[model samples]
Target: MNNPHQNARMTPLGRAEMVRRIVEEQRPVAEAAAGFGISRRTARKWLARWRAEGAVGP
Candidate 1:
């Protein structure tokens, strides 16, 4: 399986945007995680961070 985001480096802003797409845009976490080449657990982590601390969360 060739996944572009698998080894790609993303900026914090970029990661925030991805989180926005999932949260604000109502995108499915599993689908977004697959597109990002990350596990669903990671996607949830990001979402949790975003929810707890807005955009600049770690």
Candidate 2:
């Protein structure tokens, strides 16, 4: 199969940016999600990762 997330809207770095937008830029979770073209829940998941691990990715 083609690489997973090859057609995805955002990459791992994008998720980090999303977390930055929420934490550093003070953007709302929904607004961050909308800006990144992802769902609020997905944004929250990344934000949660940032909270729990202070970083992005596995």
The prediction achieving the highest lDDT against the true structure is: 2
Model 2: per-residue Cα lDDT over 18-47, one tens digit each? 888889999999998998888998788778
For model 2 the TM-score comes to 0.78
**What's model 1's TM-score?**
0.73
Query: Candidate 1's C-alpha lDDT?
Result: 0.74
The per-residue C-alpha lDDT of model 1 at residue 29 equals 91
Which portions of model 2 show Cα errors greater than 4 Å? 1-7
- lDDT by residue (1-58, candidate 1, tens digit) is 1233565555566677778789788999998778777788878887888788876662
Per-prediction TM-score: 0.73, 0.78
lDDT of candidate model 2 versus the reference: 0.77
Lowest lDDT sum, 10 consecutive residues, model 1, at 1-10
Candidate 1 displacement at residue 51 in angstroms: 0.3
